[model samples]
Target: MAMTNRDRGGKALELLREGLSPYVERELRRFLGPNVEAEAARLIGEDRYNAGKQLSDLDVAALLKVMWESWNDVFRKTLGFAERSLVSELREWRNQWAHRLRCGQNLSLSDSDPQGLLVKPEVARRQREEEQQTVPAPTGVTSSAATGVTSYAGGESSSPTPAGAPSTTAAPLKRFHGSVALSPLRLGAEAGRIAEEVLAHLSSLPGAQVSVTLEIHVAVPDGVPDQVVRVVMENCRTLKFAVHSFERD
Candidate 1:
């Protein structure tokens, strides 16, 4: 008998868990070494004496989220082409089917694909790039150094969109500003996680423009950790957004 979508989803989840667990552990060790174990223990608690033992106890979903939030650096730097897609598709699968043990979508929708993984990230990136290239921004937006909001109601741009391409317009670009407070005790990478979450929330709001530019403001104190800065910048860039890190006394 042919496998149902649910059955396939279940199997996919199994593979995802099996495949990602070791990858996560190996990368964690490679990047941060013993730091990874302590971090993992902190997230889910140190009920188990050994970090590996504790990690094994975490289910796939929790593990995925924790890894993304805490190991943003490793994901960006170390993960290879195929491994990256696997993580991306795993993320999508998790979100679409959060409640059920198995998301109802077939993990391998294509026959050529291996083990229901290996999604092409380029297709999505190219589509977004094209959309961004075509969105027409209103002219004359000046930033008030005080408020940081870009005003776009001034004179129009002298140059026009290159002819022969479809044109699109929106009211104007509003300079979006957001900040998140970081706890020194927690994984500084959480700043990046929070920024990504904020970006997701803003994009989802009603009346939000289809194409948007966001400037994430992160306030850092003296002696800020490198991980915090790296993760926040990397995450914002991944979303095609900008980040401003402001240091204050």
Candidate 2:
């Protein structure tokens, strides 16, 4: 949003005024008492203080504080919601995103490669093939049941089995494993709650044949505190999740 705190503060003030103005006229004026006109000028600012002047966007916060001090529940709740970023965390995430991007840009340059040359796809492919020949996967990354047919491992049996012979089929349960890059800005501190709500809703949809299993891997920057990681992990513990610290470069 490229917003300063005052910009957010001002926008919040506008919303507060829109939601509270009518109520103020209907009931709050009585509380302001006899000095209503002076208060109107006071609410706006000395610059716009002429008689019959209407309230300005800036007036919203001051009036809200006045109502809050008067122990008005609605104003208190509204202010609290904005301050907490509970309604939508994105509203306050702009500057953090910009700062992170700037840091990333600075880190991507070097002496020999000032432009930060990237590896070609063919070179990357060769590297991958070399790595594959050197190391085999100890465990498979994906297992499938939804898309596969069940089968016997030893051999298919056409003839009838002898009495008391146990029939068996080896079918591994399905699982998919992968890491997800968590956007600290977009997900923020509310990542756990948002993740739960999304997975729950999607799993319940009509066409979902099986409950989805997820393992979310958070790419956390070094400066983040362990407490934050713990909180997010605890909140989103329904799925397999781990906060992995990653360096910028």
Candidate 3:
């Protein structure tokens, strides 16, 4: 029998719940302390099908609001969850979302452009070359003995040759590759507004999933940060989008 849209959505929700169970359990345990097991059981006990149905268009908007509020509460009470290091990472994710919101951009994550992040090797090399050219070499001095030190030959003997100054060279600048992921939803059209809002919210976290098989790297200096990622994932999940798994390089 052909499955109804509700049925399909229900199945998907079931899969999501099952797949995220471990992670959810771990996070709940970390945040809820001793009550984590009981709390998680209760949260999961809620009907997946019913929950999926509740997310229908009419109620999604409201549900999203509630979810965001809940996330804020959890985030605040999570204690060490938003440490300085994590906060720093979240800032970068936030910037990515800000760019997508303010501008129009989509990052493609596929085999050819996984995570929509890539480093142009040539650009890095060129930058290294430019840095090397800018550093100046130390000047060297050579001392020669004065042929006529006696004062009789001239009014004043050549000033004593200054001791040869040691020469030094600047260290060569090393090349490091840096790349940024484009937003999955490109900027421009009004259709992207929701994504922009979601991105903005997630960018404040550490990481997120951009697709079913691809997780957005939110680590800083290398990928998106944890807090921002968490926010992004929460937003995606709230929107009923499938979150992808990410493989670190």
Candidate 4:
């Protein structure tokens, strides 16, 4: 049997937790010293900790919150602002997946679009054919042969075209790529809205390859040195961030 979206999302969350465990553990240990486990239990849930759950066994949300809440003291040295995008996106995905499982339905387009809205080529072709089957012109319409303009009973008129003008068709776009700078993204509705906008543009153009690079503006602290800036950018690349840059005042 094929894996459902639910299963795939669960696996993705699992992989994310596994990948971040080492880093989360390292930071927590550094910050919390010998009290890492105790503090983690308090932050995540005392019950789970009492039930023998360790940091590695905690959920992705818990791990992410630890890093996010402790960013100033720990994660900020090694990670840049763009990494916040990863944290926000993954946290939202996790939340959506959990909510879907509870509601037994996928999130609405306004909430998320991981699978996207694009149809297959055959479906697109069929849709175009259906749309091209013209409807009968509205009744009581008048055509002005002198100006090539048509007027409807509703008083709406089509734009006048010069008679016998050569018809022109626009060439299909071969590729599309663009980038937009964004402020610090928060979890929940705001992140979902941004994801929806990006996917909506992609879905609009069938058969066109698209790439969207979101440049997240980083507001560095008062005293973060140049060396820390280099480390942040390097760490972003090591973690497979596709495009990143850093600037200091």
**TM-score versus the correct structure, for each prediction:** 0.43, 0.21, 0.21, 0.39
Off by over 4 Å in 4: 45-52, 101-249
Residue ranges of candidate 2 with Cα displaced over 4 Å: 1-13, 42-52, 55-59, 68-249
- Model 1 stretches with alpha carbons more than 4 Å out: 45-53, 80-89, 101-179, 182-188, 204-249
Q: Distance (Å) between predicted and true CA of 169, model 1? A: 26
Of the two candidates 1 and 3, the one with more favorable lDDT, higher being better, is: 1
**For residues 120-140, could you state the per-residue lDDT of candidate 3 as single tens digits?**
224324444576588643222
lDDT of 4: 0.60
Q: What is the C-alpha lDDT of each candidate?
A: 0.56, 0.42, 0.39, 0.60
Q: 2 or 4: which has the higher TM-score?
A: 4
In angstroms, give how far residue 204 of model 1 lies from its true place: 5.9
C-alpha lDDT of residue 143 in model 3: 30
Candidate 3 local lDDT, residue 184: 46
lDDT of 1 by residue, 130-162 (tens): 765886543345445565445554553323446
* Alpha carbon deviation, residue 50, candidate 1 (Å): 13
Steric clashes per prediction: 1, 0, 24, 0
Best by lDDT: 4
Reference-based lDDT, residue 73, model 4: 56
